[model samples]
Target: MSPPTITENFVDFDIPQAGKPCKTWYTIYGDLGTSKYPPLVVLHGGPGMPCNYLKPYGQLASKSLIPVVLYDSIGCGNSTLLPEKRGDGTFFNIDLHMNELDNLLKGLGIEDEFNLLGHSYGALLGAWYAATRKPQGLRRLILQSGPASLPLWDEAQMDLRYQLPKELQDILDQHEASNTTDSPEYKEVVAEFTRRHVCRIEPAPKELQETFDAAARDPTVVLTMYGDHEFETNGTLRGWSSINELDKINIPTLIMNGRYDTAQDKVMKPFFDRIPRVRWIQFSESSHTAHLEIERERVMEVVIEFLTEDV
Candidate 1:
């Protein structure tokens, strides 16, 4: 079969703080205007990570004839970079991202009808947008490997950390206490944790590696919003929680995670328990990015079935 048609464009986005207009880079797989299904807007993880890692989802356009939209949130990737605003927590809050997503939808003219799928940090953004904005066009929701609350995430991660070897645990504690997360030793330890819970696939996929490189190049957004450490939360989003807001998500939602994901089952349970219409699935052998790991085909099949099934 021929490759799916792909189009790339930048939507002009205005940020009040910048005092000038910025652009949001986005890519579309398949023809949005003529597709029978509502376009699916994908939100990638890492407030700073780009959409490159989630590019695999583009397959939906060819497999299910569903238009797929992927965009880099402001302050990250092919979009506008705000290195000057680094360490400014107020400038890189979740509200900015929500507005960016809203602007991208309107900019694309698909705000009137679309399906939403967000992975990791993107899931948190998607849930907040759906619950608060209640965009009339949003038809379905998918929250993949995302935490329901920052407090819960921290607690779960700490539990996982304690399970690691004593020497590794001591190294993490020493580095965190010294505020030396930038050290190569600390980063290597974090990478070890990531391999076990984030992506178990050895020699990470090229797309996923691109995301890592992007984050390493300019960690402004992640540093301000998420923090220097992966398992800890000492950034702008430290106290954020969406447990109460889940009830507002009235649309059908799918929540999935890996049995070994950093987003533990407890972290994702609130969505399944609170969202009025929701289903949960767990990939036994996968980690955080199940779609790119062992269950790629199964992940695609489950998502297609969820998106296409009647309400």
Candidate 2:
């Protein structure tokens, strides 16, 4: 009946490229030191997106007594921002973010025992970390509406784009071909696609909108790591894939996506097919942000169940 205990702080992070000091902002719901369960470290999407939209998931702390950890990836949210790093692909690559996550874990003193739940781009990062780092303490993995690889992700988006109305399809093609994705026309068409596949909820939740606004205000991370186009990749992550390394992810895994997600079943299938231990669930009535938009309660139930069940 009472509000969950919340703690906010900054972890000093040193970035070699910046040649200066940096910090990662993090918040914890529930008492990590006192809780019996390992903390659930949440990774948000957007390679650049802040952690605002994912804040709802903090309920696990209050509801189930599981500590929930949320932090803005460096260059996003309350963490250090690098507007000057815009278009600097060499500096904004995945490894930088991964290292930041690693630092946060050690700084929080839970790197040894923790669960991971990643959404969209965050999912991709989670998969990579589990597969490559093979952290011995990682207990469970949740990949929420995330693709296994960028190429497969882009392919699925192209397939979805073709299914759109011809008029809208033509508009996207014309704008993309002209490299005018910044145009209002292109953005409008993109918004149409986003409404259908990204977040079907009319007038998205305030937290979701905050993430979008943060990305728009400083798109350095998305623009440099992902790219301007929604359906394609022209940035540093062009051919990224973790298919071969998936088998290394020895922990129990749960993969989820909406029926209408841009991360179509095809893109998520590789994770299910390759991971040694995994479960897949698709929300029939949801899109990309199933947890925040339409199926919040169900999503929480499924995640909580997975996190608590003895394996």
Candidate 3:
């Protein structure tokens, strides 16, 4: 049977730091009230990237009978965008995101029974949440292209940079050193790097491209949380590392990444080694955003199998 119609709504969230009410925009697919499969809450990557690219996750709802939820985190996408929050290290922290996520769950009334699928930065957020809170309701975790340690992530990226053509590498280095990341030359190299490690598809999927475009337009959140680019570590989250804490995530976990993923296997090794009940898979033909690229079908199948195995 086909899944129920998707529903889009907004939840009023109180951001204490902003001292104003911010509404989080979320979309739900399938029948939340009646589905036997545990709802999967998909957390999109980027400290600022919205959930638009994750819209395809609704396929699980229609095909596998799983409910799916996607939302734009605070200061991003359809949620409130606080440009003023940018460049202020003290304002954006891990806890701020955690609290917002907690509020989203409570508001959606799914705090008691839900699964989490976090990609990239979202993976870090979800992993940190699971490690620290150990929420009783969180049944499973899907970490896709997740970096276990920011330092290791930077290291891997630098290695990838070295592999690039010397001319492109020089452009990246020169621009970054001069704080001229906005230059077209810098963006050209960034795109080249993305093609190699972000998504290998000839043309990025529409939704994925849209997300990239949005991040390019207003990179405040990503800039504040992460850095000028993938290889840089000058942001507030530069020192963030969840490697030592992965052991605390006792729930069944699935870790995925493309062979050419920006979050290289070396960076994600700690997750496989430390998470007690973890399954690791590398997509040989894909990259960071494999869900929308070459391994799309296989990735979804594996995710559904993992989520439904014990159900």
Candidate 4:
């Protein structure tokens, strides 16, 4: 029950198009700087959401002696906030994140040796990086509730939408059709959907809540990268898919999601079938955020085993 040893800092990241550099906040647990084992770079979901919820993974540093790194990917949390970049879709594309991640790794001097664990959008970013960059040192990868194809995820969400209460569906349809998704009615319906598919917990954990609060305070990146809400992809990231590039990733991979996740089994299946060395596991009782929602210990066990094996 001892507190985790943690170190937090900010690294300067150059955004060429922006013609300047911004600080990307990062935190590390355990002795990654000196450990023989490659550190684990944990990517939080929400091209905009902060990495607060992923804090739970820091326990790995103490329990397994594996260094765990978490960061607020530019524009949210402790990182530089640019409200002016909110509506500029081109400015918040996947490449923006990829570049920032690359810079972060190089700055930490671990670009040559590290494991990647991405959640949701973070996983999408990881897949894109691995398939494209093929970083020489990436030894393993973990995709938690990640979507192989944005279109596939939308289809699954559409299916779930049909099951919502008729009144709720009407509210959603009304707001979406009118381009007034900011309406309270629409938000309420989305919250309902979120409860069932995003995180099943009645009241989300404090850290998770903090991420949401951060997003609310500055939704520029979220709106530009992922639109105003989940279950919908109306931003720059639409049509994104890594399914075709799965074969490019040769490292050991683990695909995980909850049965009730927004990124359901069908959407995740392509990843398992396409990746040469991969394993898939579904948390039946959980939803999107399985690590914090339920089965945290089990997730850690599998993760540590996969990362440490043959290392």
Candidate 5:
């Protein structure tokens, strides 16, 4: 049977990147709904991780009576890649990303409006958008498996690193000291770590696995943004935590995480405590990717209720 999602094609437009603007493309999953129903704009994680895991969210089009838009940032996924800004582009910074999103919304005719559903790094992106840009049209914000602070991410990954077998930990330790993460042995270790807590579904779903495979082939962007392995953040993203400063967000927010997620130290506590209007829901089976971890019915129930329920 065909999936019930309604897909909308897009054309490229000049979106800013590294101080200069570049062409970028975006896709929208439109459903039978009106402007009264906010278009949920999805921001994917990984400074470079495409909006792939979010592909399952297309299911929202079929299930919910609303519009959902999915787009890749400047140089990742289906968006245009700017090799000119390859390493030193300001595009990697959060402020630039926020602005890019702003411009995209305006160009695409959704500016200052629409709901935000950010996962992983995208959650931080959403938090920044809400706190800093303060888009006037946002109705409710949904953050899944997001860390309020970069330090929280660091702390969580540090723990995940230790969870590995002593022997595996030794390999990782050696790689860190030698900067040999590209070694075949290291790839094996990375796979082992992912199998444990990244996703509970054995072999993972095809859509989810395709995303992982894409990362494996050209991980430069992911590594450049998140660093080697999913356990640590010693890359350029160091010192970028937000938990302590999350109080700036003055909007309705939904925080989600999986029981086995790498998000650490009662991860949702600070978000709920600091953000006056917030709700936290734990997905029993999902770690980082709740949308795909559990059954479709279970996943959409929370989404429908949260997105459509009386606020």
Candidate 6:
């Protein structure tokens, strides 16, 4: 991995959220050759998290001669001040996040046309934009380690959570049942599940750990919708599934995953089968963050192949 060339200053703007307004900060990076390449917009995960961990994702500049924009959504990273916003589960709703994403692109004048790629929760936001708003000039789409439906997400997590040793599962069960979602035991169980399933990167990166450590719970968001544990979904998003809407996305789409990804094998196939113009590819040895886990050259080659197919 080569070091990134810091060339651009941050761009700031405000976008609409459900019932209020939020500010967003974005930056664009490029190689001189990018003058002729397609524009790519990268979306980071965490409905409430920041974009620091994937800062290394800027490496894409080495391969493309085009502009790639990356930004922190309203609440995460370098974005503006979060309100004394009550997490009451309503703060992290996908609809609000999707609106924030759309307004960000439109604010930056990229809404008309651009390649879309999203990771984890960001994937859901991207899909919502592409499907609902159907922004013009939209090119290709990439979904990495994302889920299409909350039910599916919940189901997959349940299966993965039990894979944890019996002792850990018992601790998790006790914490959830006793309404101790903030218990250290619950946090440990979540961390173990994350280490084994999410990134699988040994010596977890500092950026990611910081994000996890400072992660403020919008119990209102996770508890009301995504359930409390790996197998939970308690909010309106409990029915927030997208398998049926896959066909609504008529653009060429790439659905990818890592071999050891927590998203699992069963759930991804449905996205592939249902989306009209879709391709399914998995990194044979990688986990959730394949774009980082796999060699950069190899990942770019695959990305270029798909993005260039009908161009």
Clashing pairs in 1: none
Q: Candidate 3 on 1-311: residue-level lDDT in tens?
A: 65557999998888778877789889999878888988999988888998888888889998798999999888888888888889887877788888888888999999999999999998988899999989999999999998898889899999999999999988987987899988998988888998999988878888988888888778888889887665867889897899888899999999999999889998889999999999998999998988888779999999999999969
Worst 10 residues of 2 by lDDT: 226-235
What is the lDDT of every predicted structure here?
Answer: 0.91, 0.90, 0.88, 0.87, 0.73, 0.69
Put down candidate 4 lDDT per residue, 1-311, tens digits, no spaces.
Answer: 56668999999987866656689999999876667689999988888999999998998887778899999988889998888787887788888888889899999999889999999988888888888889998999999998898898889999889889899999888887899988787888998999999888878889889999998899888888777555678887788889899899898899999988888888888889988989998888988898888787888898888888887
Which lDDT value does model 1 have at 145?
Answer: 95
| True lDDT of residue 44, candidate 5 | 84
Cα distance off (Å), candidate 5, residue 27: 1.9
Q: Can you write out model 2's per-residue Cα lDDT over 1-311, one digit (the tens) per residue?
A: 46689999999999989867899999999998998788999999988989899998999998788899999988888888998998988898778878988899999999889999999999999999999988888999999988799999999999999999999999988987888878999889888999999999889889999999998888888888888768888888898999999999999999999999988999999999999999998899999999887788899999999999873
Candidate closest to the true structure, highest lDDT:
1
Q: What ranking emerges by lDDT with the best candidate at the front?
A: 1, 2, 3, 4, 5, 6
Q: Candidate 2, which segments miss by more than 4 Å at Cα?
A: none
* lDDT of candidate model 6 versus the reference: 0.69
Q: Model 5, which residues run further than 4 Å from truth? A: 1-5, 11-21, 32-35, 216-220, 265-267
Cα lDDT, model 4, residue 68 = 91
Candidate 1 displacement at residue 17 in angstroms: 1.2
- Estimate the lDDT of model 3: 0.88
lDDT of 2: 0.90
Better of 1 and 5 by TM-score: 1
Tell me each candidate's TM-score.
0.97, 0.97, 0.96, 0.95, 0.89, 0.85
**Model 4: lowest-lDDT 10 consecutive positions:** 223-232
Comparison by lDDT, 1 against 4, better one: 1
Q: Tens digits of per-residue lDDT for model 6 on 1-311?
A: 35435453444444334355446777676643335556678888755566666655566665544467777766555665454543545555776667676776676667766888888877776777778767777888988788887668777888888888999989988987898878787888888887777767777777677655444533233333344445566655666777776777888999888777876776677678787888888887776676655443566777777766656
Candidate 6, residue 15: the lDDT equals 38
How much does each candidate deviate from the true structure in C-alpha RMSD? 1.3, 1.2, 1.4, 1.6, 2.6, 3.2
- Give Cα distance to truth, residue 274, candidate 6, Å: 1.5
